[model samples]
Target: MFNVPAITWTLTAVLLLSGSYHFLQATKSHQLTDRVNNILHALMNILMAAMLWNLVPSTMLAQIAVLAGAALWFVIQAVARPEFKMLCAGSQGRLKCVYHSLSMAGAAVMVAMMGLATTGHAPAGALPMAHAHHSMTPAAPSTAAATLGHSPGLAIVLTLLFGAAAVVFILLVLRFGAAKTSHRHGTASGRSARTAHGLEAIGAAVMALMFATMLA
Candidate 1:
């Protein structure tokens, strides 16, 4: 759990820089997609950071503020660039925004959940999983069971969802290898964008594993 928080901070820092780059490039190039992407990612980073750090006013309303802001930015982007097909990938641009939107919400909710667990507000079922206090022997079978026994349903659901997403992104990275430029981006810019997508896939896969490990 603690390690995940550290990784989250590192990832958010990188995204902060990446989002700023898009925003700055958009300002210079006057590219509609870049502008929209900037806003979308900016909100994403903010919401993610807010949730991870357990910032003040940590209520659903604040979470909605961040998510609603991202959704509104998305709407504006779609309206501004009706032909904006690719959010961050080359050929497979389907449901990119939807994935991002859901991720934002998840980040916020995870923050709240973690906060609850930390404050001892979590339900009784979560206590064993949280403290691992069910046994004294490290090698006890009961200990192993306790690690995963409380959240079988949620573990299965999240594991499958994230596992599939990881597989899809990995295939996309492979497919993007010899792929032609779907958009009119220049050679350097196009390569950079595809590389970013590959990185995104890697990040998603790793995050999925983290969640699975925690639940398992």
Candidate 2:
């Protein structure tokens, strides 16, 4: 069986760091739109982290509502704030555009997984927070991975969704890496690009392993 706790904590850390980077950058720059974007990204990460660690409500209605809100929040952003939309400029930065699109798409997948679990499909790492102090380590909660395989349909669906997401992130890493490599000036932008690429690679690999292990 896969080591669920290890991956859960690792992904949680990655998401927190990524979200913090953008959030802080936005705050410093006084860019309200970027702030909103980063905040939503952070919220999505928290929702996943919560699900992974069983840190939210356990009932189907409660779970579905939270996940639905997270999912709809993305749509709400695009509709309510034209400037915050993920749609990239047509003039330049094709790679950046692709990255943004993939990020949005990946968030959507998170919502899908939560929705599936909300309906009692019980996809891997789908449990919620402990209801009481003593119930934290519910024996059933710890066996999320084993239970995942029991739902063949959800397993296959997750396999495809996360597999494709992994591929997208790999492409994103390449996209960022290429930018870093081609910039021989050793400028501030180059350093930032490299750091971003490193994070992309880690996130891609983590999610890839997660979906692969759960489906297997």
Candidate 3:
């Protein structure tokens, strides 16, 4: 969880919107793999939004397990042979799958970190807003915030990982936007793809910011 209320709400809004978009796409997609991918992304975004407010503490372990499985699913798709028509097929598709794997893995780690931080500090299913939004200064940390801030090494690693991913995704969004103008016939699909990349960029940046705050 983040200390800054504005950042928290902004992330929550973006995640919810992204999750809703992916959920709708999942419902609409005809391809099995695409549907599964969309569903995983939707769940990841929604759960991440919930995490910002420390919602559903009782389901923390379950969330982590599901996200870890989703990560593995993406990894399998990325490594699958071309003969596996149900999985990622081409080089670009596999690369995208790899990114998806990392995203899911990152989400799982985040859930785990929150779970560890919140343990013994709040009752199951309780909303501990104060614990989530406590001052970052060591002198007045809530119990949960104290736990989160102690692991500087892990936080630094996660911050860098998500930051780099955000930069890459933002570049992809720009590239997609530039290409969209040259390909008139693919405008709709191109726009949708760019939107996806933009959402990914935003999500990754949020993750980076949250982890960076743990260093405070």
Candidate 4:
């Protein structure tokens, strides 16, 4: 009977739709690589949404729905496109795939942990506020208590996974730049690179903000 925070849920939905827009653009472009990237991007957004949603004190059913939806999307993409599967098997693609896979796994663990915490299945030591009421607690300790009391493990794991994803994404972008460099130099290449760079920056910023908020 847990409910999702309205602000976080709204932001999650917005990010999800933004990813969906990218997929739609890829479909219109009719390029196989672009389409595959867009689909994978969409999957990442969905995974993110599910992760954030799981942080809320929600029921196991909601958590299952989110994880199952992400798994189903990944499975469908893997089965429906041989090229995409091949990309995932490649070195660079594997890096990106592994990052996302770890993200999904971390999200699942977080959801399970949240469920356990809510249902009193977690260890008593896992509770954040257990010993904060003592008279000898330092000011720094109290500050830490205020900030870290809520699921610090989940926040740390999520941040690490997201950072890994961003690093892999940057590497992929560099690979794309190197490939484009060998081709005929043109204004179109510059324009496209600029656009891609802007999008990547925006995505990174949003993710950073999300991670910061989780810590808060």
Candidate 5:
């Protein structure tokens, strides 16, 4: 969760939009794998946005489980043999699956971290994933120490990883956009691809920022 309400609200809106777009794409997709992929993206985004506001606290563990399972699914797709035509076949497709696997795993880690952080503070009779007050103050020395103890070196590592992912996606967005521009009469498919990359870039950047805040 962010210390700043503005940042939190802005990310919430962006996540909602991204989630909705993915759900829409899922509905339109003809391929079963593509539809499943889009639905997973939609669920992940919506759940992440809900996490920011500590909504549906009882389901946090379930959310983490779902994300971890989704990550495994993507990994399976990535490593499947070429003979498995229904899975990711070519090198590029496999690489994309690998990236998605990493991202889903990262998201699972984030939710788990947040759940642990708040567990001790929740009232009796509530589950470990119960909600707590969202503190806007900078993390005190004691709180930081506790986080460091609970998370060790994980936060900074995720921050760097997501930051790198953001840069890569941003580059993809630029490259795709440039290709469309140069083609003059670029296909609708090209524009849609560029837009998808742009959304990916935004999501990566937001995740990176969120991890950085955990470090702070």
Candidate 6:
């Protein structure tokens, strides 16, 4: 009844439309990098939606629908932008490489969890309760049902990491937006400035939502 699939579909639609707009701008300017980045961002959003949908207690039909939608989006990205395949092909920075590697690993884990959940093989008690119902249950536990049995230490570590990443994302968005604005007002060329501005705003909104959800 939580209907996570609907939420995911809505988010995916937003990302797809945004990505399409960015892609059009990139084509007009011949900016391959911007196009690639936009496509990747779209793919990431779809994958995230799938991951969230998998977390909800849904029927196998619903889970399959979510997975299929995400997979279709991913395939479109791969076909449209083959260059993204080299994102981590030859990277050599120890910290940066490790960070990206871990991120990908985490995404994989989330996808696998979704699959298991769909098949009813996932660990029990992993779905969050409706906030509206909380007030009616006086003895309800503070910890989310979805996170019950999870290691507190791991949760803390992940919180710190996600928090730091959120900050860095905010800074990058600000810097990118400023650079784009400066270029747009006859100060410089600032190719793909508009796309950067859009991404910055999206990143900020996403971070805010994540922070709020974490607190809740």
Name model 1 segments beyond 4 Å from true: 3-34, 49-60, 68-94, 120-152, 178-186, 206-210, 213-216
lDDT by residue for model 4 (1-216), tens: 124477676768666876786777678766675576577566556655665655445445455455555554444443444465534554544544454444444445545544554454332343454356444553444354343335666676666656655665577567667666887453676656645554554455456546545554
Q: Candidate 3: TM-score? A: 0.82
Estimate the lDDT of model 3: 0.82
Q: How many residue pairs clash in each candidate?
A: 0, 3, 0, 0, 0, 0
Model with the higher TM-score, candidate 2 or 4: 2
Model 6: per-residue lDDT, tens digit, 162-198?
Answer: 5565576557556766766776653334434544544
lDDT of 3 at 57: 77
Q: Between candidates 4 and 6, name the one with more favorable lDDT.
A: 4
Q: Name the candidate that leads on TM-score.
A: 5
- Candidate 2 lowest-lDDT run of ten: 84-93
Model 1, 38-135: lDDT tens digits are 66565555554454455553354455566666665544433444355544333334356556655554444444444444443433444465458446
Cα shift from native, residue 20, model 2 (Å): 2.8
User: What TM-score does each of the candidates earn?
Assistant: 0.55, 0.55, 0.82, 0.46, 0.85, 0.42
Poorest 10 consecutive residues by lDDT, candidate 1: 85-94
lDDT per residue, candidate 5, 59-156, as tens digits?
76678789999999999999998888988989988988998898899888777677657663322333222323235433343364356336737888
Q: Give me the candidate number with maximum lDDT.
A: 3
Instruction: Write model 2 residue lDDT over 12-107, tens digit each, in one string.
Output: 787677767766665765556556655655555555555555454344345445445544554444344345335332333344434444444554
So what's the TM-score on candidate 6? 0.42
Model 5, residue 83: distance off in Å is 2.0
Task: Report lDDT (CA) for all predictions.
Answer: 0.54, 0.52, 0.82, 0.55, 0.81, 0.45
> Candidate 6: lDDT over CA atoms?
0.45
Using TM-score as the yardstick, the better of models 1 and 5 is 5
Q: Please rank every candidate by lDDT, starting with the best.
A: 3, 5, 4, 1, 2, 6
